[model samples]
Target: MSATVQTPTTRPQIPVTVLTGYLGAGKTTLLNRLLTEEHGKRYAVIVNEFGEIGIDNELVVDADEEVFEMNNGCICCTVRGDLIRIIGNLLKRKGTFDAILIETTGLADPAPVAQTFFVDEEVRAVAKLDSIVTVVDAKNVVARLNDSHEAAEQIAFADVILLNKADLVPAAELVALETRLRTINPTAIIHRTERCMISPTEILDRRAFDLDRILAIEPDFLGEDAHEHDDAVTSVALRETQPIDVNRFNQWIGTLLREKGLSILRSKGILDLKGSPNRFIFQGVHMLMEGDDGKPWGQDEARDSKLVFIGRDLDAVELKAGFAACVA
Candidate 1:
């Protein structure tokens, strides 16, 4: 006796959107809104921890970070392997969800997340990496961007950015902030909001990973240009508690840029100025740098400056000492 089996016919791949932002940048709030909103499309959300989802259903799964963590807070290493196992398992219950949403930890970099969908054999075969929707906190973004390189990387990789908590800042400041964000990531579409409110259509199914879309946004996102932090491209983070001398810091940065700008691809920081009540924030792309005064330090806020550098062959000791020289 002989038996014949038929393989399941392939269907249109499910769209996937990655939700990311700095801590307290309103991701969970936005996820809550997305779930509660009347979008009519069922969603599967994967997160690092389970909390405050409200809706009681199997749509949400807590992500077990079997993947390794990078210094900048990205979990892309083994995520494809994990997702392949999880999503493949989720497929057994096919027809239950129209799309999938992955909410990585606030400090995560979306590059690795996006890469998983493009390279994983089983994952890409069944699911498409739709877009990366990053949430930015209007009031606190300056500090967060200055302190976390992941924040900058998030903006760099986003197809859409929900600039939430817009009501907290003035229109002029918001405009200025948007301009700076654009300079850092020229490709992202920015949407201003209060309390994470926005239309679902704006972020979902953007096909950010499509070759045409990627070429339109930034051609380097897919090929050898994608930085894996190998020998040619590397990253480092520096932290200090002492307030920096604004003028001295500027001079030091200017000289560094003049000397090493080409090798320095991205630089970002939130500085504690010796005499200022407000935090001084700044970020740079190559030789271009911009900065502005940020929210005043709270009565009890900790005053620490964090700086991250991603570039080619950066001399950590020299750079660290030069930065330290700017301290008061």
Candidate 2:
């Protein structure tokens, strides 16, 4: 008898979809819809709330594993670290879940969270970033965009723009909102949703963050002027080779957020920890912090920490100094 040889099959990494928008933009409503739908794939949802009230849902199955609520009240501030920890924990019970859906606070920017999947080696290995779905309130979108940088970035980074609460606006108004969104993000797939009801399948696995598209939008991804931005809003990337003193970093971050949270739109970091082989992941919005341990370091890996901050009129010098103080 001839011996049979079998090749091992490698499972594809699960994709994580980030849902973001301004406060009261119907993120929770959309999440609730997804949770109830019979989509064949089991999902692990991470909902970051900006207040102390927990999500009071009765339909959630496997409550602990299926629904994770970051009660930090600052979605952008605390979600990145919470995400890493939650995802890491979920991975340990592999096969129990199929995908991850993170719902950012309504007034939060989604870029920092989206960047987390790419910047963190351990995170990248375990999960792939699928898409950023921004739920826009049709009735208030124009005013929100005019009033907040967070609103603008949420729309700008979206792979899929869900113009939720479309019924609240007139047909003409909705059309105008669509046009404005196109002007900001010409390539995003736009969907008009009533009461935040849409097929989950429509949003999943849609590799929306195409590098070519981003380049087309910015046209300066690699140039020295890439970090430059208009008044009120900017994006900055910070990097270091040394591990961070986690406790000091936390204290510094806490103080920084408390003092300047209103100015900072979003902040996220993939830290190389001092004396620890595992990477520490953290993300925050204004005054919230969430973090957790990631996978072990590989021998060929470079131990470095990289963080990205997106905000309004951020003083780079002071921001860099604060990070330097955390260095081991």
Choose the strongest candidate by lDDT.
1
Off by over 4 Å in 2: 1-9, 51-79, 208-328
Predicted structure 1: lDDT: 0.70
Model 2 — which ten-residue stretch has the worst lDDT?
59-68
Regions of model 1 farther than 4 Å from truth? 1-7, 50-58, 68-80, 208-328
Candidate 2 lDDT over residue span 1-328, tens digit each: 7697543345568888888887788887777777778878778777664522344443222212122234433433323655666777778776777888877766665645764664456787789877888998898887887778778788766778999999888999887677666655544679999988899877887863332232233312224433332334555556677889988898888888778866665566678889988877666555554677866788898778877665666776888888988997
Evaluated with TM-score, which candidate comes out highest?
Answer: 1
Q: Roughly what TM-score does model 2 have, to 2 decimal places?
A: 0.56
TM-scores for all candidates: the values are: 0.60, 0.56
User: Which clashing pairs does model 1 show?
Assistant: 146-269
The lDDT for every candidate, in the order shown, is 0.70, 0.69
State the lDDT at 56 in candidate 2: 42
